[model samples]
Target: MPLTSVEKDLDALTMTITADFPVPVRRLWDAYVDPRQIERFWGPPEWPATFTRHDVFEGGESHYYMTGPDGERAGGLWLFDAVDEGRSFTVRDGFAREDGTLNTDLPLTVMTFGFEETDGGSRLVTVATFPSLEALEQLVEMGMEEGTKAAMGQIDAVLDDLRSFAAELPVAAQLIGDTQVRVSRVIRGSVDQVWRAHHEPELMKQWLKGPDGWIMTVAEQAPEVGGRFRQEWTREDGSDGFGFEGELLESEPPHREVTTESMIGMPGDPARNELTLTPVEGGTLLTLVITYPSAEMRETVLATGMTDGMETSYARLEDVLV
Candidate 1:
């Protein structure tokens, strides 16, 4: 999270600010396009902005107001003249009245925001052109430069908050005939975080155990396509233990994974496991489906209270994520 560099050029009657954000271009673009997200970081550090109307397309209009420390309201407007999704946009920014109308007596600046993908993440460049040097000086005197920089500084935290919302506990188990058992839950984090928790051995060891007394000592994973993994579970006394080995048939980071799981103690056949992560409103919906060779095999596992074990394990997983 580098500080934005603000450059004021009175000779050109323009001001430009450039900053690098350690997030994807889409995330950076959303700061300018999405009203809900924009409101979180659209003003100075202390003076927060609230949007009343926001339409982020070409020829659209946005109306918002920033609240001062003493409860003073400063209304502003953005009239979009051009828009290129995830790329660039140009808008006219000016003072507005509280009733959602522009105040012609105030100065206006035409601002263009450009987003570009960088080696690390994304770079955002904003250029504001004023009608004259007097207007530019007026804006600078009004603390626009410092206010805009402070607003941009909040982007990193806002993006993190957007990804780390509350989780929803899904139905522990749904038995679909004899062929499948679905275990699903919504984790309160990004798709990448959830995926890494499942794919990486260190994160997996945090929550992949069954009962209270059992400990997962070994978690070896090769998380690429055609890779293999093994998980070993042991009791506190080291008297009772079992393990499962699996091969990844399909692997898609932050999305889906298909694998074949074979338990060491199981007498019958191996199970095909499919884990899918879908991006929902607040977090990721992780759906784990276990398919058996036959209905009898599924019934046998269900009768062993596998659903209860999964429910307990997933409940413990909440702690790991938070």
Candidate 2:
């Protein structure tokens, strides 16, 4: 499932949901930022939502109602506290009357949405903060957790429509070894530019990301065969993030390079990464081969998704190259 985990912290009075999408961060962000798009996937399939009013700026108010299969209606309001375009946003959510008036008698919560670009795709972290542990537990008992998951599960369909409308091409991948898969892209830059984008820490920071809001806060690298590199990325608030480190197994400038990458505080062993750059007619052909320690690992990675991240990263690389 796209929804990976749902964690509720009693002491902190917060419930957070982690979900990954095999779509560009910009496209996923639009699912929330665009009112027309928001209504499409804002509720479970059985209880679709309709927005009567939506304004996403700071202090703006959005009013919507979800209609159940049985014709029951649940109205809600989102009082925007802050909005960071394409990266994150904070809102005060609560029940509302059909006329868009806040229902003070009902439960209210503060919600924050954070988006990050990961190696596989875009990771969306959503946190709902309640007034107290009691309030949180009460919502959980009301099936808020399950409802939210069901609602988010529909995001893939929304993204699929957007993808079709944009007519974007998917990245191509091929099985090159028993435990390896090769993903390739034609980058619109010279071999030197493509090589720098992959080898130089500064250049790498510009395009090696899944979504739009995140920045490579720390990028340190050494190009020698025995040298090591580290890259850390985080949101502006630093509430959720991760870093990875690796050692260069082979370093041939502008042509080939290899490394073993291991994530901090993550399961599974390190994976081997090999990159090849070939000069092409109008640009450079960049190919990346990832070798897993086991066939199961490789299959798992493919099953989870990787094309969106690769396509987004390449698109960003083209922007940087231009």
Candidate 3:
């Protein structure tokens, strides 16, 4: 009843209409067969309903009725050829008269329904095969394409909401690369001044909180190119905080310092943030290079989430330096 897609083949003037839905193929098939559920949005729900027969099995006959203010009647029937539970099926749809007799004006159609997972999501693909492309062209001239698009648009929105209700944890990561969010602020403080803040227990409490369940037992640093340091942020509730210790890549007192944290001892998975401090214009320019080992890893240190925390640390650093 709802068309999701219509891919055109202009070379042969052929088109394939598809509706990839989140619903199981069997559920979607049931809606096609059940007149009651079909009434919700089938064609138009504003029309009045007339008592009709609904037979939704392979060999059952279906008869339904609709009446308008102007005494109009519209109904259809489908003979299901196969019903596969939760998979796919085929059906033949045709129009019928008010008295349940077949209408010759309606063309019988063979619709193939498919259920699959597309890009980690469920999709129901339906394709109606016509007798020939000429019939398809004739329907195109009758504006079938436009109507189908409108119907499928509604169907897609419904399906999208349905899928959202299912609730999958969306993966979080920077849409752009990690370097994109990193900011470098040059300060006039010497490396010893920065290094002192890095190791101060009071300073640690002011900024970097350790893993959610862990506390920083120590904040130590070895000021050398190959030196290693360990810092921990602790929660009084005995929960963990985000903290790690990594080797220093480069170091020059009052000049530049680079360090890395594998984040093995933190609340989240492993990632590296390279912090650089350089002397510039009688001050030190601090460049932070946050290397997310993976997209998910990178999101753990988003600028938005870390803004307040980082600012707190910077303020504390200023206090200690001044």
In lDDT terms, which candidate is top? 2
TM-score of 1: 0.52
Better model by TM-score, 2 or 3?
A: 2
Off by over 4 Å in 3: 1-4, 8-15, 22-34, 44-51, 65-71, 156-322
Candidate 2 lDDT, 1-322, residue by residue in tens = 5899999888899999999988878777766755446778888889988665455556666777898989888989999899886788899999988666998887899999999998887999999999987788888898899899889888888888854323133467766436877675667888789888876777888888666667777788865779988888886677678788989997656666779988877787899987766443346656677888899988887886667767887898899989
RMSD of 3: 23.9
Q: Give the local distance difference test score of model 3.
A: 0.52
1-322: candidate 3 lDDT, tens digit per residue: 3444578665544456666555554345444433333443444334433323333334444455555568687766666677663466567756678666778775665666666655534566666666567766765785556755644554544433433222121212223232333444444476556655555666655444422333456677655678888776667885655556788775544333456666654554444454444332334445454556676555655744665555555644565577
> After superposing candidate 1, which stretches have Cα over 4 Å from the reference?
164-322
Q: Per-prediction TM-score, please? A: 0.52, 0.51, 0.40
lDDT of 2 at 158: 81
**TM-score of candidate 2 versus the correct structure, residues matched by position:** 0.51
Task: Give the local distance difference test score of model 1.
Answer: 0.77
lDDT of 1 by residue, 54-170 (tens): 555576667778888998889999998998866888999999986769998888899999999999899988999999888998889989888887888888887666543224544
RMSD of 2: 21.4
Please report, in order, the local distance difference test score of every candidate based on alpha carbons: 0.77, 0.78, 0.52
